[model samples]
Target: MPLFVSMTAGGPPDQVTRRAAHPVARKGINDSPSKVIPTNNFYGNLMLGNQNQGVWTHPYSLRWVKGTGNSSSWGFGVSHIERSQFAYGPGNPNKYFIAPLGITSIILSAQELSNSTALTTDSLEAFSVNANLAVSAQSGPLVTFPLVQGMGFFTGVYLGATALIQTDVFFRTLSGPWTLGTSLKYKVLLEDGRTWLFYVHSSQGYVNPQFILRSNTTIQGPSGFRGSIQVAKLPEGQSNAESWYDWAAGVYPVTGATFGTFNNGSASYTLSWQKGGDTGKTLIMWALPHHIQSFNGGVGAAATDVQLYTTTKGQATLVASDQWVMVEKLVTDMGFTPWTPQNRSVTTLPEKAIVAINSVASSELNQDFAPQTNLDSMYFSGKGLAKFAAILIAVNDLARNPGLAAAGLSKLKTAFNNFVQNTQKSPLVYDQIFKGVISTAGYSDPGADFGNTYYNDHHFHYGYFVYTAAVIAHLDPSWLNQGTNLQWVQTLVQDFASPVADERFPFSRAFDWFHGHSWAKGLFESADGKDQESTSEDAFASYALKLWGRVIGDAALEARGDLMLAIQARTFQNYFLMDSSNKIQPASFIENKVTGILFENKVDHATYFSADIECIQGIHMIPIMPPSTLIRSKAFVTEEWNKYFSNGRVDSIPGGWRGILYANLAIINPKASYDFFAQPNFDPSWLDGGASRTWYLAYAAALGGCT
Candidate 1:
């Protein structure tokens, strides 16, 4: 069988013919190490060189300090930030919150590992990064560290190599070589008033690899030892932390490999360790705030006192179990019709709404839709097509105007055909090196279309196109089998949200199931790790996927999208959308309402393009569709508007941002939003290129604004 298989008969060509060269070259990425290819993950910096940025695992961050900074040895540098260590922007309510880095608690290294040793990743998976430390260019790795997110232990597996542990924070006391099951445990007290637990386990059984405290900051292990070393930090003032840790210490030597599964409205993921020592022992893992909120009833009792604070996602509770099942209500109720908070479809509009929708649809359809949509940037082009598609849907479904809908659909099909034929200004190419589809615009200019060729915001850029195709297919089902139309759209879907990991594309490249959200930053090394800006666009992409799946009759894809949206809703509410009642974010900063850009190490209340308050808030409200009501609750919208855009503040904001805010206001105050968009002399400048007045009116009216 060929490596790249198309979902439809006339789908994308083979990789050999469609492959194009990309500008940003990958470094140190192992060739076909494993079946999985993770482009945007927490451990992406491992592909970069020695000055690698931090890879966050939440509650803890690890980096390769290649004989630089405080440490003079090549090792996995570990650090954890306390709540007091955070730096905040100046204000009564701070604009941003950042966790401090470079506080190296310890460096877990082997004596053979040094600056000259080659650091390479062997296998890259959705949840883990396997880092290898080789003695020289041609020699095998002396140690392999499987670094996983939310793992309680920083485990290192050795191949008869000596262990050398050093800490920048001087060690104050070293206690215990006591045996707990098949492991030897030691408690180390650091000068910085932090306690750390270290355990050593040998697979050969009962062989003691004596570790001696050479100095205040260094510990040396016996030469030619074969086993694994595990390290974990104890939360301050938690008396039962050690007891809980000890209960699961027998299985600590066995590192876990994570895998996820989703079905119906429920999703479950498991971290199963390769069996070692006591077969009955359970694994110890940390659960993020969202995970704890959604965990099923099958798990063991959680260590309530043994909790650690994550950098941005609040507290992580210690759960000594292996599996977590998250049940969420999927958005199966939404479809082609205009959806309302009551979950009812709007078949007929009031006379005023019909008049307003028809007038705007006529004006929008008369314009040259091709020039507006057939642009070089996928982001802008997709927005253009989606804009017209929304207008057509509103005219046909709500206004009951078939003639105008027919005219609009014709123009929309012609505009969408340009992309299906791959004749756009900047054509897409199957990037064989990265194993995904990308825009050629970035090959010439790295920053073009916000680095689409480099894989930044694939979900945002491709989502609009998917939504447009879904609308077209729903309005005219024959379009599904028309000249590779379905196949072309499927290629884009597979590129961003492939259901399985295969040679053609990585599984869920944009969405991170473990994080309960998606990461927008791609193939870039940042000290803060992968970050996402527009939570609305992120949710919109999943919404697009859900509708596209429904229209094409793919139940599995629809279910996947439904589950993703559910997870995104839970996580966005917990981390991104800060309601007054939200306890995850800081009290001083939760007043911002929405986290502008949520990075692994920080959360900034600002956008990359503009620092304006409307841009920051309205970016999360663009293309407000059905899922918008599900994710952005009425309470959240009311709180956000009252905080930022209420009291006549929204009127002062210029450009398309104003329209986005008003459209979002429909979630809580539908009548006011409908009145604003349906005004006699509505300003065209207020509408974004991706938005249309017809759809906003329809959206508000469907939500009970048709007075």
Candidate 2:
């Protein structure tokens, strides 16, 4: 089974695969105490329960082992000795005399592997033996036995009781390596008052290994040192018959699992069983070598005449479906037959099981909630469409469950129709001149003052709805949102075409600020006073105008919105992205001394809401900007959508729901918005009255995959 038997001088080089690690959650600001967490705990402590995340393989053994535990033929990628049957002897011309007689080998190349060449080496190096045996034993004859004893340092002796039960030479190495030696030991064992004679052969790389010894009635044998009574050193007062045999100094690199000839030929296979605990514990070693699990399990060894290496599994195993795909690929590539899917699920690890389950759950939820009746639930906004759309946009992941994704799509389509129908009836009538009367929280008593303005800040409500619907439609097209259904959207978008007189919505009023008299900040900020309402009006309105332009896909619409944005940007400069300089004043008309007009942050949490109005509106004005801009922007509607995950869970945001009613102008369609909002954190419990309704839809969508 030698991998290479070519008389050719040089062969193709080994293939190297480089994997780029994906960006995981990096260590941000640590809020913990001063105790250092061991990095290794990241793996050792990670329990896969009784299951596993599945495993992958590197290139894999393309060649199949076509038999059972004992007799099998691994044609391709076989070890060097497997193909050659001859051993390299003193004067013998043949190097292949009985050579193919090992289970594996430690084949090396011209350039000995530098111990420091690799960064992530295995822990076995600290031990006494190299587990893999793939090399030309510098010693003599090819033969191996169960390790009986190992003692001393260099010039150490390794006792191997051969099966022949005859006196033979034992092996030892002092200066160079452990190889075949030309000496033997007499082992005398007493049984039932009778003395016995036994001859033991030895092997060593440095000495001639063609000698034997005879045994007598001496029954006691020293188990500690095999003639290894001293350490290696230059003798000043030496008086030995063979003073040249100085013991080796302390062994440098301990090779605890040193593998010589497995004693099994290339045609011979081995079946080694293992349990947890200790050095050779199978599970401990497997888990310690996380890189190994990436491949299917097992210590994958390579042994060709030209090369000896190790490989691992692939990435697809984490997800169950891909297991069969990879297995098929293995079969095809190896020119061997493939394995049937069979009972793979039973064999897979726990990680894969959990993943499969979660995938199904998310899928079901999306499908049931996405259909027509599903949208009928109070998913739309009475106060604003944008607000509702933002909350409803997390249907995409559900598609993994075809039923849920489909149902959700249908539901959203019906909801979209209802929106068009209702809006067409009223045509989104507006009483202009910055009325400031539309209380997004709902129809308030005449005295309850809120942001009831036809200004820039109010426009933030528009992007929410349109964006949600657009995101939904992008994932699933069942929501037919063309024609008159979009008229209401166009009318609201028209407001963005002109800059309003009131800075509350158009000019720039509220930011994530700290005004002394009336501090109103980002959606999640602590509102300190009354007039805090107007502080964010310009920001929100600006947000709406830009989004409207993009969804409408009209250059004039975009231009109109951009013009107003430019004016708002100039006016709201200090309110959001201030120069941190002079001019700490109040409003011209109301000299109420706005103390903390802004709260800046290196992280965009606070500043983003303040300036994100521009990013959102800018994208609307120019639809070519990156999508991340829209997702990251703190446009009013966008905030509502993000609210699903704000508390680390998905659900409708009560405070923002009303605003959703009016923000439909920004959505590409109904389904579009839903898809985008349904991120990994989506959950039905987020909504108040719609809890049961959303859950029902989720059930329908996930294709009855609860089990």
Q: Pick the candidate with the highest lDDT.
A: 1
TM, every model:
0.95, 0.26
Quote model 1's TM-score. 0.95
lDDT against true structure, model 1: 0.81
| Model 2 lDDT per residue over 514-541, tens place | 1111123211111111112232333334
lDDT of 1 at 487: 79
Which residue segments of model 1 deviate by more than 4 Å? Answer: 1-11, 14-17, 31-36, 49-51, 204-206, 250-280, 300-305
Best by TM-score: 1
